[model samples]
Target chain A: TQLLEQSPQFLSIQEGENLTVYCNSSSVFSSLQWYRQEPGEGPVLLVTVVTGGEVKKLKRLTFQFGDARKDSSLHITAAQTGDTGLYLCAGGRGKIIFGKGTRLHILP
Target chain B: GAGVSQSPSNKVTEKGKDVELRCDPISGHTALYWYRQSLGQGLEFLIYFQGNSAPDKSGLPSDRFSAERTGGSVSTLTIQRTQQEDSAVYLCASSPRGGGLTITEAFFGQGTRLTVV
Candidate 1:
């Protein structure tokens, strides 16, 4: 079975602090997607990384794809209270395999 | 709909009862997917429909779970004899095209929360 394992199941940091979440897999993926979900709502796509060793930035959030396409990471710089949410990583090909996710809380 | 839409935002059913969840994909989307998210867990893919044809149903947990799409627009998922373990958020998503040779982003709908008691 294809599985994406995420680290640091839960994180709580003060405002202005930085954090990083990781998604790792044994199988290679064609693409990797990052999503953030608020309570009672579905996940909102944050970014997609298709190329190996690629890095993309959106505001304070940065996403990196591993050179082998078997892992990815999300780094949040100077997190704010609004950044508190469930963050998920999905590896996609014909179907998507999701990681358990990182539940982050940015205390202000 | 401008985005994928799911019906009955929340449902509470007794064990052994059956329930149906619906999904309306965005217009022009050809690939639809069903997923389940348990508390504090990741999304689990359940099924995939490509323009009214299901090319992959391997993620379905059991025979009691079945889904179908009609006219390449809306899809329905039926869960027979609901169990307490089945309680979760059922999510639906749609993509522009099937991920056969290339990958595409999927737009998701606010999921339906099912509670079996």
Candidate 2:
């Protein structure tokens, strides 16, 4: 069984602060994806990183895939109230597995 | 549909009863997935379907939980003898395809919130 472990399960920070969350696993994946989910809605895909050491940026968010494809990180810069939500990292090709997720609360 | 669509945005059921949730994937998408999510938590994968055939059912919590996709377009998840622990937002997603080394984007539905009382 492959499991993705997420660190800092809960994070609360003030506006304009920066934070990084991690997702780690022992199994290698063909691709990794980051998703953001707001209340009452399903997760929305933020980015997909397929290559080892690959990095993708979406506005204030930066996502990195580990060189071994066994880990990933999501860094938020100058996070605002709008950035408050659950961030999840998933890895796989056919049957993607998700991390428990980091619930972020950005204070206004 | 323009995006993945799930029916009965909210469902409240009595314990021991059965319920069925529906999903309509985006046209032409060959891969459909079902997941369950508790409030403020990550997704718990339930099953994966590739063109009307379920290739992975390992995520299904138990025999009480079952799902099927038809015509490679829509899927239905059925839960029998529902329990309180089954209450959660059931989410459905679809990608253009699955497997192989290539990466694909998955589009998700708003999800069906199930409440077992």
Candidate that would win on lDDT: 1
How well is each residue in A13-104 modelled by candidate 1, as lDDT tens digits? 99999999999999888888898989888888899898999999999999999999999999999999999999999876667667889999
lDDT of each: 0.91, 0.91
Question: Cα RMSD to native, each candidate?
Answer: 1.1, 1.1
Over B1-117, each residue of candidate 1 has an lDDT whose tens digit, in order, gives: 688999989999999999999999999999999999998788999998889999889999999999999999999999999999999999999999986644677889999999999
lDDT of 2 by residue, B1-117 (tens): 599999989999999999999999999999999999987778899999989999899999999999999988989999999999999999999999997675578889999999999
Model 1 chain A: weakest 10-residue lDDT segment is: A90-99
Off by over 4 Å in 1: none
lDDT of 1: 0.91
Q: Assign candidate 1 its CAPRI class.
A: medium
